[model samples]
Target: MRASPPPSSSLGSSCQSSQCQTEGNCMTDLGSIRILYMEDDPGLARLVQKRLKRAGYFVDIAEDGEQGVEQYQAGDYGVLIVDQNMPIYSGLQVLEILSQTGELPPTIMLTGTGSEETAVEAMKLGASDYVVKDAAGGFLDLLPPVIERILKQYRIVEERQRAEEALRESEARFRAVAQTAVDAIISMDSRGRMIFWNHGAGDIFGYDETDVLGRPFTMLLDATCHEKNDPPMSFFEVHGEARMDRGIESLGLRRDGTSVPIELSISNWETISGVFYTVIVRDISERKESEAKLARMAHTDALTGTFNRHYLVGLLEREFQRAKRYNHPIGFLMIDVNRFKQINDQYGHTIGDDVLVAISHELVETLRESDIVVRYGGDEFLIILPETNGETEIARDRLVAAMAASGRFVGLVDFPVTLSIGCAHWDPQDPRTIDRILNDADEEMYKAKRANHEQEGSRAQAPPTFA
Candidate 1:
């Protein structure tokens, strides 16, 4: 027969058959919790087993520590309660074996009185807790609560591990995307010091990680740009606590000290440590060059390389407005190539085209840099002179001299090629529109042409004097 179970205030009296029965429906209500108990003392083991079984726990008993290891491996137990002073292998030795084999369950070590050193050693070997058995066997009362507490703590640890694993996987995915991005991706601190630079940054800026990490981000900005604005600062510096998302077009300096047009976007993120800024940069140099080329093609004449009619009209309107506002004198020269159609008829259109090209070159060389020359139409051109008074005749004389010196018509035609020029000056004192001034110059040009025709076709003719 088993020895009478150790006396307990609650387990023996309060836990009677009616209150804590380990039978059918009652046992099902108290979830199944299998416990493995290893103790060298038969009397103590029998008493503890009876108390646990009555409380609806399924208890498996082992005679010594060595048997405890075999029972633990053979059966599934939610908790292990082993005696520290067991024969052969002790509680600490059993814990070591279980730990080496695999994961151990929630464990509690039972030590004899004044064996605090053994209890400490057991705990260090992976026991969750240890109890000192009293002469009255009072330690048996503490086991249930200890097991519950250990299970709660274990759940907490498992949750924390899962969270850490998820964070690591997220970081890995972000790194993979950043490494393969085509645009330069960079991260910096509030002080504009580089913290991270990806592969695209190296390809765009020609600086490897070793060369740029920990350096100021201003190293990649043109010196002139830095001087024009504030010192290169992160998005956090400008906006303070607010989140920023914006893009700017600026010049980025390369490793070789040359600058490229760059489109930069800034985004800010906040963490417990501080705010960080992410910058995405794209080189726009090729796009800028393409736009400039398209603009030149729109405003310039393909054959003569002079200002096209569209651009010339805009220039004239702008100049007229300026002259009206500033009370400045402006001059206009309307010129026509003499006998151009007759030359084309006599020597084919190719010779006529050559003559027109040569005339355009001569006019460009003769005029001052401030003068505006335009290829207005077939066999016709316009020259605009700003901030001039009483210089119209001087300009006409220069053009005649330039044409005589130029040998463009020598081989193609027997007669000399000359220009009939009409001049008109805007006196701020006179009230006249741009259209009126242009019409007057055009009418005078035809008069010069008629006069030259009447005078046995003089090489060049000048307009009449204006009052």
Candidate 2:
């Protein structure tokens, strides 16, 4: 219930010095700041209410401690004034109840003359100050100043709390953003020790945060990969260096000691502790593999999987130039399968394709890695060998034996197929241009084919054979 209203003793919007009985005791404006007063005595509660209301503060009076606690919780009050003695709950009990909810507002205890000890106990329960009651009402004037001082202190505390809460939210947002990145995000301390590691780091480097944190940042790097180049991590090891950059390719070491190609970026920032670095690493292994595949496709024969004519021209040109400069001999062997058209016509195109694949595989296995086999055209191939001077006859003979040694379906055919090869060997001093030499080899291949056909002699042409 509301406390009794005061008798008709009032002041202006603010208390004048003469009205307060003490010099320079004027009330400042209390804008929208409410007050809660708990005083069981009817006369005193009304007196305090009227005086504060006239001094421009909206005041709500609770006649008992229980009612005071309820009104304190229900209202947005700036200050609480509770008397020590009450009907149900004492001033200390009210303060204790409010403290359980959260930090209480600026509260002052009204104590009787010898109850200074109890006031101190109330302060421990979160009361800001205590006022001693007197028979003459001399303590009434002290209320305004005590309330003002406590509210000032309360404002300062609230601002600091707001700033701290804002900082915590900002950090939470940053951690969220770091965790969502697809690439690995790492944070290092001034000593280059990892302090923060995101989930992406775990996925890429095959390591957990527990396994990574407190480890040196350099542990993830392959030192051997950067020996010829300057190390990127060195700038932060010292106090000052402009080592921050957006990107660079580096080899990242995994937990299994395998190397992974990664595009990495690191930047340094200053904090109170010293310098820190943020490193972002992306695994580019798939991208590198794709680029290599594209390069191969651009220069490879799709059906036979041998080097195409385009690659052959480039290789021939480069090799010819090198042979001229180094004064070495380069050899070209042109080979064709005899009766290939008859095989495709007799055995269908599917078996023809398989035969072509098989032939290319055999040629690849027989040739040295340095020798390139080109699918010059259908049923024909060109072999380019560098620094293999005067080895054309030997190389051709080796190939013929490899093809003829094995038992193959060629024996079942009416006419067995064979490979006819033409060899051209040239020295740097030879007058023939590389193109002319290639043309001569092509001509020689037809001559060799006719010679083989004459030896095989008269029969319906057999199905084509790669033997």
Candidate 3:
């Protein structure tokens, strides 16, 4: 090997040190740029190395092209400076061989003064730049600035490639999420015309992408509601500001011309093209149906499907206050099925429940819609008549006549099916408590029951049974 250049200069540092030799399998350390120079002239190599080292570079020298390639493979370098005329191989030959290993570093080719043709040929062989050399060594001044410019260009290219790669990955992730999501994800332009429809939107709306890509977004809403909404109401876009929603309920018109309940959330983004909106929609029909069923179960009697005692308590309090305020006439009918226990004991509880259900239905059908019927207790019902207008007994008589005409229990095992009906009128001006008024109706009912028993003692027949 040629003697090592003086410590004052090197074209590339001898990486006898383990760290530099193995770095990324030859990737240079950018923090400290190290360079390799190949030249047959020892004096010229030494001068070049010293000048570059003074310019803040670590430099090492190889005597010829063959040695230059060998030293390059053995060390990490940020730059390469090679002489065109070498003792064993030409600088172009060295460049051609080094290209096979991997990408070469920012490189400068050294040529004799006035040999611009040789310098251009070196550039074609992958040299980043070329330096004109003379006996006086005027080329050193150009070397540093040329190296800095080439390095800057390399960094710009790498940054551009990374940015393009990141953008492609982001687009791929968006396509995957949009294609697989279960909720309808729809995109609309600032004017609210549909632009992108994904798999979820097609499945929900019963339309192909081609069928609705250019349609108005409001086509998915009920006609009556869509008119009120238009496009401006669907999203909040004020100036450059955009707003997002947690959820808003709406009616969605399906392709089959039916309406479905849906919930929507929206997001907005802006691009050079203009503003855009994305809407996510979820179907809520099942939730609405469940809520309605639960509400009914909470307020109605489970066995007979009539308003239960709990509902009646609230209803009575409101009605009581209203009557006391306006001095209106309110009537109560305390109705009890005669011998209901004897019917259940003879016919079984199954029939007893059926009888109660039938009675509840009959009471509802007989009364005005404004009237209230409550299953007050086993075998007992309370009917409320608002603004009775002195027709309390008349209303009770009409119910009895209707039940007889319907023959509700006439053939049920020959049992004498009858009702003990008692009426109590609320005198709004009186300071009596509701409990006392209800007690009066109860006492009147017992009196009616006793009278019915005395009147029918000779005629009442067998206990009721299913017909």
Best by TM-score: 1
Q: List the candidate 2 regions with Cα displacement exceeding 4 Å.
A: 1-30, 37-56, 61-74, 81-97, 107-192, 198-200, 222-250, 262-289, 317-328, 408-414, 426-437, 450-467
Number of clashing residue pairs in every model? 0, 1, 7
RMSD of each: 8.6, 8.7, 9.4
Model 1: per-residue Cα lDDT over 373-435, one tens digit each: 898899999889898898976887799888877787789888778788888988778788778
Instruction: Evaluate all candidate structures by whole-model CA lDDT and list the values in order.
Output: 0.77, 0.77, 0.76
Per-residue alpha-carbon lDDT of model 2 for 303-406, expressed as tens digits? 89999998887888899899899999988889998878888898877766767777787778887888889999998999988888888778887777776653
What TM-score would every model get versus the actual structure? 0.73, 0.67, 0.61
List the lowest-lDDT window of 10 residues for candidate 1. Answer: 1-10
What is the C-alpha lDDT profile of model 3 across 156-258, one tens digit per residue? 5555666777988987888789989988888888788888888888777888889888788888887765556546435344212322435777788888888
Q: Lowest-lDDT window of 10 residues in candidate 3?
A: 1-10
Model 3 scores a TM of 0.61
Question: Which scores greater on TM-score, model 2 or model 3?
Answer: 2
